[model samples]
Target: MVRKHLLAIGGALGLGLVSAGLAQTIEGLDLGAIQSRAVEQARDAEAFLSAVSDRGKDARDEARQTVDESLAAVKAIDPTKLPKVGEAGAIDLDEMVSGAQGSLDNPRSAPLFIAFASLSMPEDSLKQMIADVHKAGGVVVFRGLPGNNGRMFAAAMRRVVSQDASGNVAIDPRLFRAFDIKAVPTYVAVSTGFTPCDDFACKSRVPPFDRVTGNVTVQYALESLAQAKGPGAPVAGAALANLVRHD
Candidate 1:
């Protein structure tokens, strides 16, 4: 008889509402005021849960949109367009090979790295910088001016380890705007999407890039990156030190 009364309490009252309905029908209980308040509280709880669910959906949508934008921004280049050798007398044959252990792409990839270098940079400096990035497991993409020396640039690259021959390819102009880069030879540490960046990705907690100039050694810049990666081959003393010591 008591169960029959709760079943009749309009459209499933829920645990809270069911309790209220039972208390309401209790003989001589006179709990009408308390039962009415319970209904309101139950409704409020349901609404709050629904709102939390909606927020989760919105957050997922935001993540999807971000991934799409990053994919659209990525660009590729052909190595055929660049020179495979430097000027007849420009290269120092002895210092060409990087003595660092492992290949150029051997660094830990938690925070993706892509170095934007200019054609205007001196032959020796650019070569050393490229080697450093590679030894530290970063990618190199070259940018040239209206009168840049593509031949010498290509020639210099032939000496260092350029993963996938990307060193011979030109930089995508879109990368400049994405990272807000105003100069060449910028070592931008990016997030997963290769977005141009001055610092480590915010969510990733990686250290940001230190744009290299004549004042600072390229090896130091690369070493800093290896250290930021924490425990890994990039942090190994020999490989990391060799990257800076080779030059």
Candidate 2:
């Protein structure tokens, strides 16, 4: 009877071990529903990332197009409105002084004179002189000198006269002549008929001082002219003398 009881006990322990093993196997298996849900979540995340990337690309394309359009608009602006050389701008003394004729019928309308050794005068001084002439209701004619300073002097005159729009000053090389120009940088004032005159004379009257030095400053000449009395004399001789001295 004892042997029969031992066999039954061993059989019962073997059946309990088999049932534990089967329970462990069932717990390890993956459910189809859980796997399907995980795949759907992964697909949603991928779609969200793709949409963000596409939006960024679209924004970049729009920005590029906007920049291109802006550049095109700038390029399309009209260039004619800008100032150009040789346009109907202010008259330059250099260009005008050339090809000038001494017989410019309208003397009072515009002052004309043949500059002797014009290149000897400084550009600033010449410009100032031209401005003075303009202020005195006259135009200037810059005649070319035989020396190398001709072009340089004319250029200086051009720089100053170009600032005014009235075209009051002009330069003309054609007016240059080999006359007895006793004084260099001589300024011969003219009247309504364009006739040349000195301090005391307009129509063949003798100048008070006939022998003026070529190197004499404008101040010296004006002072001498102020002391004399005649036609073509300085309008306000004393005032002009004072102005030249101070200048």
Candidate 3:
């Protein structure tokens, strides 16, 4: 059984405690949501302090409240640091390779396999997954965590597996916080929709095809996505890709 830890990330001023070294945990916290709410709290607290005079009792009371809220906000998880998702913000996923960019018979725009990886996650394992995903003509998106030394992390990854034909993108760190990711090596299969965007701007939105398939190996991730898009079957991550013809 995977042991999920209770995590508390402190100090947005400096997120030094989180990284590839510590165990990855995303169990019960909607960290991205928490951070957003906290920022709003901190802003409100700051406004209160700026207007209150320090010479009166209101000043002391306001100061105490401000300090408390500030501390909480600074310690809250910053969503800006996670990967960027279509729902959270603007991401031109069309730039990446897709069924439209590739072949039509290959299944709907193909699945977007987003990987939340860190240095702590085994390299050989990740490399194999990358290779398998490419073989299946899937997109491999890498999401780096806070504790990663950018240069060293990429160098390490390159040393293991370098060729990703479908193409890969380093997800916006803030985007990682938006999803309910619980651990490293977690894979999300976006196999049903064309434009990953489901907001008001997108007219061709389908039921959310984004499925977090727990912690799975690379081969399993690809296989699961293919199964998810089958003609009639509707498994969590096992459905067939819902491809459409380009006009």
Candidate 4:
């Protein structure tokens, strides 16, 4: 009886975690729907546990198979193989500043910005955009793991890096919320000494910045920002000059 209960609990928990991970894998995915499905799955797991007493091997086998598959999928992602600046999936802002074209006493003093993107975008376009951002000393930020698995993220990143050798990729979901980014390939050039808050709901005061959203090239976006003469204009202008000089 204890063994049966343990199995049921483990199966239910695994299903819930897997469901959450799967939902997060997709860009702009809805978690509410995934949570509802997870709840239904938990109910199904309970039903399977009850069915066990009635000699219902079919239900038990099906539930076990599902749990096994889900676990396998989650295990497939290996974070070790993914390219990281300091820690796996976490960006080291200090390193990002050092490799950047401009010199700054404090890492945050530079008008560091993020190019919000996703792995779901077109391969050629994504690669080109990454290359452009790298040239401009901007970081490419992904909201989360591709397919909610580290192995898949690593594999996808390897393909992108192979073409552009863009090593400034970072995975941070908070930036999405902080910047209120609703679309992919959005370019945000923030003012100097600007720092995002740790809490998503905190709504800390964000420094002045210029933003461009669309499928436009980074050069076009920077030109628009520089012309706007916003708080981020000088930084954007400098980056634009670097891009042009290199071109």
Query: Number of the top candidate by TM-score?
Result: 4
Off by over 4 Å in 2: 1-90, 93-117, 145-154, 172-179, 189-192, 195-220, 234-247
lDDT of 1 by residue, 1-247 (tens): 2222112112111111001122231222212332344434344324323434444766434433432222222111123443444322222111111101111113223224556666566767776666676555555554221222223333444544333322223333334445556776665544233222221111223333333333234556555555566433233334456555654
Against the true structure, what is each candidate's TM-score? 0.36, 0.37, 0.39, 0.56
lDDT of 3 by residue, 1-247 (tens): 0001001111111111111111122321133333334454454334334444444775546464534543453334333454332222222121211111112112233234455555566667766655554444344444332232322332343344433331443333222444545577766654344423311111233334444345576555545655656421242233223111110
Q: Once superposed on the true structure, which residue ranges of model 3 sit more than 4 Å away at CA?
A: 1-111, 145-148, 164-166, 194-207, 210-215, 224-247
Off by over 4 Å in 1: 1-111, 144-170, 191-215, 224-247
Kindly give the number of clashing pairs for every candidate. Answer: 4, 8, 24, 1
Q: Is candidate 1 or candidate 2 better by lDDT?
A: 1
**Highest-lDDT candidate:** 4
lDDT string for model 2 (6-96, tens) is 1211111110000011111111111222222334323322332333344476543443343233222322322233224342223322223
RMSD of 3: 15.3
Colliding residue pairs in candidate 2: 96-171, 97-171, 97-172, 98-171, 98-172, 98-173, 100-172, 111-139
| Ten-residue stretch with the least lDDT total in model 1 | 11-20
lDDT of 1 at 32: 36
- Give all candidates' CA lDDT scores: 0.36, 0.33, 0.36, 0.53
| Candidate 2, poorest ten consecutive residues by summed lDDT | 10-19
Question: What is the Å distance of residue 161 in model 1 from its true position?
Answer: 7.5
In TM-score terms, candidate 1 sits at 0.36
Candidates sorted on TM-score, descending: 4, 3, 2, 1
